[model samples]
Target: MQDADKNGNTNQTDGPEHSALLGRMLKGEKLALAKLVTSVENDAPFVPEIMEEIYPKTGRCYSFGVTGPPGAGKSTLVDKLIARLRAQDKMVGVIAVDPSSPFSGGAVLGDRIRMQRHALDEGVFIRSLGTRGTGGGLSRATGEVLRLFDAFGMDVVIIETVGVGQTELDIVDIADTTLVVLVPESGDTVQTMKAGLMEIADVFIVNKADREGADKMVSDLKGMVELNDCRETDWKVPVLLSQANQDQGVDEIYKELNNHREFLDTHTTEGERKAKIRRRHFLEILGHRFVKKVEMLAREDERFRDYLEEVQQDDANPYEITKTFFQDEEFARKIFGATQTKPS
Candidate 1:
């Protein structure tokens, strides 16, 4: 969720015990399943330790993030997508995030119930993460968990975000290909084009296409695409219509996805660009971690507060406060010790 400490690999308590357990889980040890879930679900005392042991081994999966408006039927879309993927003998991982309502977790778990036909199927692993107010589209450990599945050798990882509003469109940070799903009736065509979604989607899907207005929505999407100003290349972001519940157009989607993958594979500059983006994102996460830590320490430290009070009263400025905090050898050492010294 939005809790600062809950998101990163900074929570390392058990120096070795949790590491061995994480190693086992990565090695296919069955018992580690419950332990890992428990560690994450209860915000376990040693999760920071667990993430540290597992972080480096991540970034190994094709992480796909699925997001859209609340009633876009993202869950059902994922279910149908999984079914099609399973036919290819591909291993799939699903991460569903929901709001902070008391039944949020229960509702997400119920998605598994909707797709129970795949319960006995080994090719699928379904996980439901309560959003816990980690807005901008995902849970705190969303990327980490996708990496876990990747390290586990999952062929595909699907992330489902609860809300698809502007503020919730955080999937772009994690997913290589983020498909913004919209139903015909939701007026997603106009909502999407007007809200800058045209750039976010590598592909636009109009789900529930069997409805009466479906064709108009699809045409509307195509019109928007044609009117798109970015004509630098022949690559047009395709708009596809699908009736997922009826098992329609899944193959076309697979074909488009594969084509996109192929495009990335051949584009030489992509590697460097992606590396820069990833580094920037990790740095932002680190920045968030640092800001939270400083805030927490300042609140708990009398010296920092007296200085803050003086600054608030305009008797002293931030530069002086910053100088005092940095010049205080004891405080400086503690802060540095508590923070990660390495960039990675």
Candidate 2:
């Protein structure tokens, strides 16, 4: 597999068939799009090339991230949101990040089963991405998948994280707006407070509003939003109540989503927020590339294997070995393939 260079360029050449697939995807062929998505999910050798080709078509779609603890009715809310967007004649894409199946590494809760009502909607595209043991409540391919949806001309893309609280905060880096859903149960409010969800949420929702303690949870979130001084933006986080199954308060959620979008459009035009997102993306790509290169070397290079064997046999200090490995000029050349300069 070809890797990206220091200048973020890929030398991997795609075959004629791969080029044809990209062309078909650009022409709005759903099958072609599906194939490209599978390729991205699998981290195919030509992914960097595919992303480079489609990048210019991205940054046109707005993304929303819905996340919280389990059983907060996130999937139901996403279903309603998709319907609302489709009603406005918007092309919607949904990436439902679900728990991975241990045996097959596939999404345990399939997208088709979760949002079956929209399965037939031509304007709606839904995909399920397994967490695949990724710690951030999302698949490593999620950001790339979002780009795919954006380039596919989606007006709105929604990412629903694996209902894991706290560590699920990675969504804030990707989503333009994040809605943290909670239920009326006791301790849920305290958990949110302790988990720092208040800081990441643009909007806090107490779903299943008909249940006991819903009003109090809403009020608590509102109070937390008011007291949280870390927010540098003028947009006050709204805490709304909803019974997503009944579609209650969904219109309000939709309205707030539009309001937040407008706020971003007005405030984030070439601002630090956009710059920060771009920087995060760059770092993520760089980190992934480095890890891949190390893995490749471990598999293919005898020197790297020798180091690993030494460490495995406890014949060398792993940390010292790593330090020495970094100082080796030839090893650097092999890993990065960049021209090196000698010290004066």
Candidate 3:
């Protein structure tokens, strides 16, 4: 497979198939969308080109992130939220991040099973993504997948993380609003929250409110929110309770989600906050592409392979070798120049 470069040269990384798939996806073909998502998840060679073509269609969908500790009823809460969104005649896309299967490196929890009711709904799209050993409770492909959903004409996209405690703050970077779901047993988590979950929550939910100590958890979170003066914005973080199993108090949570979204629309539209988000996203893309380029080089370039061999055999100091490689003008040319000439 190959595509033409800007300078009339052929690059062996992309072909017509992906472009045809993208065309089908944009025309509302669900199968095409699914195939494109699989390609993104697997880090296909054509991802950069695909994203470049679809970038103009993104930013139309508002994204929400739902994350918390395992067994906190996060899945049920998301299910309920999806229904509410559907009731308003909105097209929804869900990216449920599940723990990876050790053998296949695929999503094992199968969130689609729990969301079976919406399986046949044309307005709803649900996908389960494996964390693939990436930290921050999300697959490395999550950001790109969300963009694909946006370009597919979804009104809203929800990202549900793998429920890893504390370290799941990456959602704040990608989601327009972040919902931190907790149970009454999570009192200890709140008490020791430090700078992690507590800082990232745009809305706090104490799910399974029928359980004991639920009220106290709500009060404690509210008190924490009051004492936390570090927020730069005027939007007050709301703490709500829900028994998602019985469908109680979900409306309040939904209402607050909209309220927060509205706040962001009005306040962060064109400020340093928005600029910071764009900058972070750019840096993340740059870092990911640079890593992929290096990986390809290590596989094909004999000199780079020798460097890896020395590190593997402990015959060279990795830090010194890295500094020397950066100093070599030819090394820089190989990395950046290959972007246009080499297959990914």
lDDT leader:
3
Give all candidates' CA lDDT scores: 0.65, 0.76, 0.77
Predicted candidate 3 versus true structure: per-residue lDDT over 56-111, tens digit per residue: 78878999988887778877888888999999999999887655332112244353
Please report the TM-score between candidate 2 and the true structure. 0.88
- TM-score, candidate 3, is 0.89
Off by over 4 Å in 1: 1-13, 30-34, 37-49, 99-107, 111-113, 133-139, 192-195, 230-234, 268-270, 305-332, 337-344
- By lDDT rank, best first, the candidates go 3, 2, 1
Tens digits of per-residue lDDT, candidate 2, 1-344, equal 33333223343355677789989988898888888877776666677788888888888899999987666889999999988888899999888765433211234445323577887899988877764433332445788889998998999999887554444666545889999888888454456464477667888888998998899888877777878888778998898999999999999999999999999988877467767877888888788767766766776667777778878874678899899899988778776885221211
* Candidate 1 colliding pairs: 11-48, 12-49
lDDT of 3: 0.77
TM-score of each model, paired residue for residue: 0.79, 0.88, 0.89
Error of 3 at 163 (Å): 1.8
RMSD, model 2, all Cα superposed?
A: 4.4
Which stretches of candidate 2 lie above 4 Å from their native place? 1-14, 99-113, 132-139, 186-189, 192-195, 338-344
Per-residue alpha-carbon lDDT of model 1 for 1-344, expressed as tens digits?
A: 33334323355556577777777888775457546754565544465466666666666567667777776767777788888788888988787755433333345575433566765687787777664433332444566566667666678888877555543455455776777777888674466445466666777788888887888888888898888875354556788888877768766776777776666567636767568757865775566556555655665656656667878874667887788778887666545564542221
User: Between prediction 1 and prediction 3, which has the larger lDDT?
Assistant: 3
